[model samples]
Target: MLQLGGYFKLIELGLEDCVSDIDAQPVYGYALYKDGKGAKLFYPLEKFNSDVSGRSFHNGRFIQKMREKAVTLPNVRLEQGTVTSLVEEKGTVKGVQYKTKSGEEKFPMALWQY
Candidate 1:
């Protein structure tokens, strides 16, 4: 699946059968928040002391790196499909339900959010 200018090879909705280890490469960006008065506040990510340098955080580059690393793993399968919905129990998310060209299915999702 493609999202946020990045291409994702989604087998499921989670990371259980996906990436082994992920590194935190902080990217600098601004978040816009609106107040009750309709005034917008622009918060720069770097100012929050997260140590983001705005250097190694290119979307396309990151996606390419992930794709490269994923191919090197054993028994990794990338399913071409569309996520129909998330399987949630109470307040916890269990997995995801997706639909491919063949039919609909479900898998144990290890990761839920980006």
Candidate 2:
């Protein structure tokens, strides 16, 4: 289910937990998941950023630099519910229904359908 899909984000990418060089961005912490597993958070990839001083993302040192500091995350979930029905008004879909850990809820929306 870990398909790396393309999407969009509208905010700044924050720093993550890593032991990078002084010039590199250092990771400050970790993220734990529900299964007692964890992974290092990193600065969201900036396609334009680079370290021309080094091997340009080819260096293997970065691998060991991370494994040496492996972390653990537990009790993590992305969302509480699956998107339920898409409500329709006239020809436009205008709402969404969902059930969370607590119960059900609805969110009204402007619609777009193919």
Candidate 3:
């Protein structure tokens, strides 16, 4: 998954530092079990190159890092809320409708167009 373009895009967005330490406790591999016995052991290092083999990390930490990096950008805005639905126009997603602690809000995509 780390070999995908989206991961590189994050690096391009100035998140290279965050990527290195995204997880507090990194998982390099995993084992599968059946009938209380180890069925198979899988390790990225054994199967793929170091560059493409990605480690598993805490998802919460990943989100935190992404939010932290996004806030530093001038054009980004972070909102805390539940996304009720997507606001689409024609066939494209044009915006989002969400509910915050205070009230419901609609954010138009045009506001962020560059």
Q: Which ranges of candidate 2 are over 4 A from the true structure?
A: 1-79, 105-114
* Model 2 Cα shift for residue 52 (angstroms): 10
Q: For residues 41-100, could you state the per-residue lDDT of candidate 2 as single tens digits?
A: 544445634421111232355455444444332432234366677877797667666667
RMSD of each: 10.9, 16.5, 5.0
List, residue by residue over 29-106, the lDDT tens digit for candidate 1. 344556644444333443434432233244565565566657677856565567887878897877777778788565
Best by lDDT: 3
Residue ranges of candidate 3 with Cα displaced over 4 Å: 4-13, 20-53, 107-112
Worst-scoring 10-residue span by lDDT in model 3:
1-10
The C-alpha lDDT values of all candidates are 0.47, 0.40, 0.61
Q: What 10-residue stretch in candidate 2 is worst by lDDT?
A: 1-10
lDDT of 3 by residue, 6-92 (tens): 444655676655656765433445568788888654443555445533445666777787789789889888777777787777988
TM-score of each: 0.38, 0.24, 0.54
